[model samples]
Target chain A: MSDDGFLRVADVSKWYGDEQVLHDVSFEMDRGDVTVLIGPSGSGKSTMLRCVNRLAEAQEGSILLDGEEVLSPDLDVNDLRREVGMVFQGFNLFAHLTAVGNVALGPRRVLGLSEAAARERAEAQLERVGLGDQFDSYPAELSGGQQQRVGIARALAMEPKLLLFDEPTSALDPELIGEVLEVMHGLVDEGMTMLVVTHEMSFAREVADEIVFLDDGRVVERGPPDQLFERPERERTGRFLERIASHD
Target chain B: MAGATRPATVRERVADSDRSVGRLLLVAAGALFWGWLVVSWVNRWLGGVLVPVGDPLVPPGAVEATLAAIPGIAAYAADAAFVVELSPEIARGTWLTVVITAASLVVGFFIAVPLAVTRVYGRFSAWVSLAYTELLRGTPLLAQLFVLHYGLNLGSYVPDTLSGVFARNVVWVAIVGFTLNGAAYQAEYIRGAIESVEEGQITAGRAIGLSKLETIYYVVLPQGLRYAIPSWTNEFVYLIKYSSLAAFITVPELYYRADQIASETFRYTLIFIVTGVTYLALVLTASKLMERVESRVSIPGLGVDRER
Candidate 1:
């Protein structure tokens, strides 16, 4: 990766209570590219992506988002979250809002867009995710795929610099995963910067500019998709690749 | 028992035990019904002995006086029949009642939300919540009113110029007394609602990096308070009935005013009937309005009507 890459994580470590979950993790994801972090459950792959937005703080080391230190003494957490949008595995759409209203909320309240502008932007984002006709639907009314698409549209409505997807498809039925992935893949095609924590190995191999494999609490491999997966040059990553491929 | 030649038929044993339990329930219900019958009989006998049933307690040897007074009572009846005469008094009384009700609601609400929060998430002890709920639900509203009105001398705190006017007024006393009492019960209603709000939603909100307070106000409350509304409406209706306790301390509320008008006119049944209708009217109106508001703010595009 070039020095001008957007987000650079170096030697990032995280802990919960006395249990250390991520250790000495290092990676650089370029501007306008998808970097998929894949590993077995509890591999701390999601933790690294969450660390960028400080949803989970890194106990030690540096995380520079857009070349500015996002994990430091003076990190503005609220500003970071607003800049880096996240879509949860459960699709945490506000149950109090419609799809349009949920998409409109951040841009309207946080960004101070006019009602007309916010609704207009929310519709456009919803339309981008193939939810044009379902703008008025609530999350409770929609399938998992539609809800995740709305989740993406909600993140996009913020016009955030980076998007984080932590097991976005894991909560959906296998049939529903494709709808969510299609929206994400479209974002990749449109040159959006994203860090995805996924078990969808085929999608990772297909769409990721880089694949970073993690285990226990450390990065096992990091490189372009071909270099990391095909020629990992590590026994750990080779096993991980085999495990993910077994899912197919 | 072990030496019994053969175990009693299992079905027979089960049937015998089931019969005993059913007989016990039957006996309990019969006892309750008899107890209610006895209490009612005694009360009816007592009222008959003291007040003399079937005899209107008019002033003695007052047939001539009654004949003379017919004109005045008739004129009053005419006013009631015309109905407009009672409107001003009802309207003023309605304003006072509404002001008291609304102020107490707001006060109770402010106290209840925090109290509910403590009850739901308290680290100290279950007693913190248990004591609150038990104490409020346990105490009589009459005692609560007297404590506020005289025992506490809430009247003494007021300026003399206002005391004579305000102390006699039921609205001020009812507002203060009713709110404190209702706040305690509302504490439970709100706590239950807050608890019923999905725990996962709270965890999800926290994962988004929302502070605990932000999560409550933004995520938890927006949903929790929705669940709380119907219960809150129940409490508000309870307040309307509870407001009648204001009469004992002399609020000149519907029942109190009816008592006065009845004493002056000797038409207790008619006046009480009117009071009942008005309270019923207030409760029904409140119910309709809250139902409408609940629907409007509900999760859009979802017809799932969450009930209390």
Candidate 2:
């Protein structure tokens, strides 16, 4: 609560059975900041993002979103989720629902809008993600890129206070990644508060206000993207960046 | 080449039509042969007795008299009496049968959906549902009917008003037995269908902030129900046939009335043949109705269209 940032994670630790996944992870994000999390495959970056929204619970420590403690038992997780949108790596759009139906579900069901109004809002959101032409297409009919765009549109339709992206383009084809990233870049330009976990280093370098490097469930280094990318203070962070750069 | 191709196409069309006509003639010949054989068989047996056509222990004019009496026997067998005299009672029985099946199915559905959800999602509920399903599914439906109708003595424990309902109507017992038996089978179908849905959909529903109940209702049930259709069709057809068991309890469904009619007239074959045809018609109608529903609800990429 002392942190003035819009999102504050303090000393969070998580375990799955006996294996610890996150160890005392802490970070803060100001409003409208696009903070990108970068790490090796098992570095708990995805786990951390999930914990922030309580999609994955953190057994110890507190997460505060807009000065409210999300880790408390009494909190209404659904209400909290209404304010925090998430796009998954798999583009898990409902297979039975068309693009517009997917987007409109949250509005009509959770937000309690009428069918026509919810569909109108859904159409606008889909258009924002450049999927205006695909409103009636089911997820199975859409390609990976179009499916991911619809996923983004579904999240965007909620008009959440913050958005989380968990490797949104990882499951897309190489040629299809750009379209989804382009929609996300547009969101950053629109000044959406976003916490993103991705290995798309170029997207990170271009759009991230701050880059948070995680290793072995700990935040290794964090700074403005240029500073973290160009000049790293920690040897672990430097090696990791060098390895990632070499891959490209 | 154009002149040659035009003649070849015309020849091919003629050949195709001629083959079809030949096949039609073959089928008609086969049908006629079977029809004649059936008529001669009937004539040898019943016709000989009635007409004395062959032996002359038969009189010469008996054939004409027998021919004259044929319409009267036909009339007595299937005529206005069965339709007009017995129809009201048959109709009453049929209405009760419809009530039994429809009410049992509706009540069973309500019982099953929740139980299936519990079995899938809740630890304690799974055990209870497993035991209940196993118990009901393991025993015979006829045995269950007997237990409900005769074994339970269900009226004495009830209040006066409902006790009368139980005493006056054995249909209530039939409905209860059917509902209990059907709910178990339905719960398994539902459980299987729910399990068939991808895990990712559940994750997606949760990620999008749908409550667990809402997720099951809006996302899971629609898909599950579609998947359940093949099994549900079997259940529905089974229900229509099984409703005949109510006759044993004196609930007076179609089979019960048919049985009474046969005994009264001493015409077991006639009554039973008609009753069997009625049951077949009911089954055919149910299957056709289910086929329509299946086509309507089937998803483009799922269910029967998966191969396409």
Candidate 3:
């Protein structure tokens, strides 16, 4: 693990009764860097992200944030969750709220920010993602790309220590994907720590500081993007790349 | 004639031959069936049927008598004034019914929501949720009412609050029946609404640092309530009608007061029919209110953007 890492996943294991999903998965994420997780469907990639945020309980391991074991049974799980914000593939904006209201909800409720202050922070975050004009728009009114950007802004509004993305662009149209990816790229430019699950190889190749490949619930390979993309060490990496590239 | 009467048209020739049969047989069969019934009925009416062979009660000329009495019956027919006249009695009964329903709904919320939570997201067997849905849904509400009102009321060891209440007052019986029946139905409505909330929203709430309970209160419930609106309103209508069951006990609610009026005046049909109309009005109001709320919360562009 890097000395300057912001988050750590250490031997986290999860099971649903008889069926096991994640098995002793471990990884370290550095501050202000984007770690993109690329994997086949049901590879437990999304489950790993959920575990980091304590969305799903981990059976046998810990997730550490800032040298604190946040996922330990004794730890305040809510505090950990607040610190790590997640944007989902489905852009989980509150259907009843306007885009701005959806973004403001977390801080106002959990952080005890006044409605006015939360609205201010919310607008600022939306503006940063170039959604300043659509502040009052409901998620239903937004395009898939726009809704996803709103999702990103909603997470960013909390000023979280880390952001988790579970296939953010998967639900967007091909054209719409660029707008959201650009928003993500802008966040990366600002040195926000991000963990993303994505199928967009080009975005990963272009923006990721590190790429972690998972297959069958284990990390197959991970390293600097240029090295891993330019020269994969394993034959399986080549086969995986072939399968992915063949999709388009 | 059959051979020679190969007349102008096939229709005429067939009719000519068939006309030979007398109408007497058809007349006799019809008369025999009806006459036999009339004779037997008359004999019974005139004199008692010989021991256990047939019914001996006098035949009633109900239809003609009923027609003749229509004017008198209409004079005693129930009106809005009946609801007004019985206001105090009806109010006592209605109050008892309302109190029972409201208390049950409020208390059921506490039990239903937590049970719904356990049913929806809890780690125990899926059967935990399944059994709850089935138990509440599969059983007849009338049976539930009877059990709570009568069966449980009969049990020896059950406390006064549980069993004793039934003997003293109609209100207690109403409360017991309302809670037992309403709670089961409510659990299902709540469960459906909770499930309708997108899982992603829950994850979002969690990501924002809200606990599971908070996420439910803040995120899922608000969303679930929207889905629950029409169903809940329908339940309100149901609660009103179900409250009438209170009348069967000593509670002098609307129907009970009306029943007494009908029994005294022998105007049963008129009063009962009007009571049915009263419920119609009650349910109609509920339906309209629910429709208004659905429109109020609905955002403009839910389905259209999906295509775009």
Find the candidate with the highest lDDT and give its number: 2
**CAPRI tier for the interface of model 3:** acceptable
Residue-by-residue lDDT tens digits, candidate 3, A1-248: 24586788888888978888887888888888889898888988998888887788889887788899867788887787778888999998887788898899988998989999999999998898899999999887889988888899888888888999999999888889989988888888888899999989988999898898888778888887888887999777778877888986
lDDT of each: 0.77, 0.82, 0.74
Which ranking of candidates, highest lDDT first? 2, 1, 3
- The residue-by-residue lDDT of candidate 2 on B1-308, one tens digit each, is 45554445788989999999996885576555335334433444476543333332323244444544687564453343343344333444555666688889889989999889989987898899889999999998888888877899552355566655433557777888899999998999999989988787877787777899999988888888888887888888889888999888887788898889778988787667766755665676678678899998766565444324
lDDT (Cα, tens digit) per residue for candidate 1, span B1-308: 56658777999999999999996885676555345334433444467553343232222335444444677574454434523334334433444565567788889999888788777766674567678768878989899899888687675565666565543644576788888888988888888888977675665455444556666777677777777888888988888767877878778666676677678778677666766766776676567667887887777533255441
Assess the local accuracy of residue B215 in candidate 3 as a C-alpha lDDT between 0 and 100.
Answer: 86
TM-score of 2: 0.81
Clashes of each: 1, 0, 1
The global Cα lDDT (0 to 1) of model 1 is 0.77
Candidate 3 regions with alpha-carbon error over 4 angstroms: A1-3, A10-26, A57-63, A246-248, B1-111, B122-169, B172-176, B299-308
Task: Return model 1's CA RMSD, one decimal.
Answer: 13.0
Colliding residue pairs in candidate 1: B170-B251
TM-score of B-chain for each predicted structure, in order: 0.68, 0.70, 0.60
Q: Give the runs in model 2 whose Cα sits over 4 Å from its true position.
A: A1-3, B1-94, B155-168, B264-270, B302-308
Tens-place lDDT digits, model 2, residues A1-248: 12359998899999999999888888899899999999999999999999878889999988989999999999988888888999999988887888999999999998999999999999999999998899898877889999999999888889999999999988988999999989999999998999999999999999998899999988888998999988999999899989988987
Candidate 3: give the clashing pairs: B93-B253
* Model 3 lDDT tens row, B192-302: 888977787887888888878888888887777667766777677788788777776555666776788788868677667756755555455457667888788866553
Best by TM-score: 2
